[model samples]
Target: MDYKYIEQLIERYFACETTLQEEQILRSFFSQGNVPSNLSEYADLFRYESSESNIHLGEEFDARMMELVERKSGMKNKVVSIRGKFTPLFKAAAIVAIVLTIGNAAEQSIGNRPSEGFDDVTAINPYIKKDNISAAIKVKDNTQAETKTVVKSDSLLIENND
Candidate 1:
């Protein structure tokens, strides 16, 4: 008779504070066709739930659902295998990338490098004659030999002073 309790329960439901028993009471009350005029707006909502609760999916529904699931599973396996098929290509690409990186670094190190050692100064200045290197070495040996003789002469002077 009184709709105040139903209005209170509906408010509590919206606020998420209503218990399950209170919700059930509201659903049962609104499922009846004799709801008051002011509560008519909520009757269709509660009646729809009561009608939906009676629906039962038969074997035909289960068979159709299984078919759809099998189709989706087949598609999923195909996509997974497709990705697996590309794994070798990805590995080959990584190998090529590593080789290219190493090759580039080797090329950069070798580039702009000077020629071999300067054993012959002629390599540095090509106009110099090959025979000049031997001449220079002889001059260096003679200078070193003269320096040793001067040091020996100094030692002899010190021994005489002693």
Candidate 2:
């Protein structure tokens, strides 16, 4: 009728300080049907432990577990084609090619336009000087004027000789 010892053992068990023998004592004490109302709550716990300890896995248990493991492993393996494995690489290459093509086309279009905010002759030939161009035009005009004057003087001389 003194459950003080059982109570002390339970306290030690929960504290994880009880020896194996002490734990067995607690199990035996609670297994009995005459537990007081205060200790009845712990009775089911110990009785379940007692019942579960007697249970053993049958010979088929290992086979069943292995079969389940094999089934899971089989599911993990997939059939991948050569194309499937290289699909990402193919996509990356295609994207790179498209980008390069667009970049080249844009470069050509930009280069073909006339240079803006700059002189057209200078844009075409960077080495030509504005002073040299003006001097060449003056020389051409002087030569044309001299040729016209010589032709008029010659015609006048012929008319005077006749």
Candidate 3:
């Protein structure tokens, strides 16, 4: 069979003008081992393609990759668990701090109060004037004189009747 079309495609492949499908056709045709003497130089290129097509990551590589993925996932879970577990404790500590601050403020207010218990009462009655005392004494003496006059008048009327 004539290989002129295949040779033309191979030239296009070297020029980087062949599509992937065209390159695949060239590799398939060269794999049959009937390549002409003039095209033997391109055998190595097609053989390299075949070998590359057969290349694969082994089971060991897959296992290592899976293990790495699992380790990363586990570390993420650990971080989430740590944050979830400590959130409540952090909130409780904040609440306790607020309560202690309020309690301390109340205690300080009670401790700093004025020591004098009667200061407010004394504030209501600031000073006793001398005139107010004299007025009270005069009213007392006027009531006593009125009582003596009533007693003397009753005694004089009883003597005149006897």
- Which predicted model would earn the best lDDT? 3
Candidate closer to the true structure by TM-score (higher is better), 2 or 3: 3
Better model by lDDT: candidate 1 vs candidate 3: 3
lDDT of each: 0.86, 0.86, 0.87
lDDT of 3: 0.87
Cα-based lDDT at residue 126, candidate 1: 88
- Measured against the true structure, the TM-scores of the candidates, in listed sequence, are 0.37, 0.36, 0.64
Tens-digit lDDT string for candidate 1 (11-122): 8987999998887888899887688998788888878877888999899999999999999999999999999999999999999999999999999897647666445356
The residue-by-residue lDDT of candidate 2 on 32-145, one tens digit each, is 778989888888888898889999899799899999999887666533455678899999999999999999999999878866633656768888998877777799999999
Question: Which digits, one per residue and each the tens of the lDDT, describe model 3 over residues 20-118?
Answer: 999889989888867899999889889888988898989999999999999999999999999999999999999999999999999999867776633
| Candidate 2 minimal-lDDT segment of 10 residues | 74-83
Query: What shift in Å separates residue 153 of candidate 2 from its native position after superposition?
Result: 99
Worst 10 residues of 1 by lDDT: 115-124
lDDT of model 2, residue 88? 99
Ordering by lDDT: 3, 1, 2
Give the Cα error of residue 91 in candidate 3, in Å: 1.9
Better of 2 and 3 by lDDT: 3
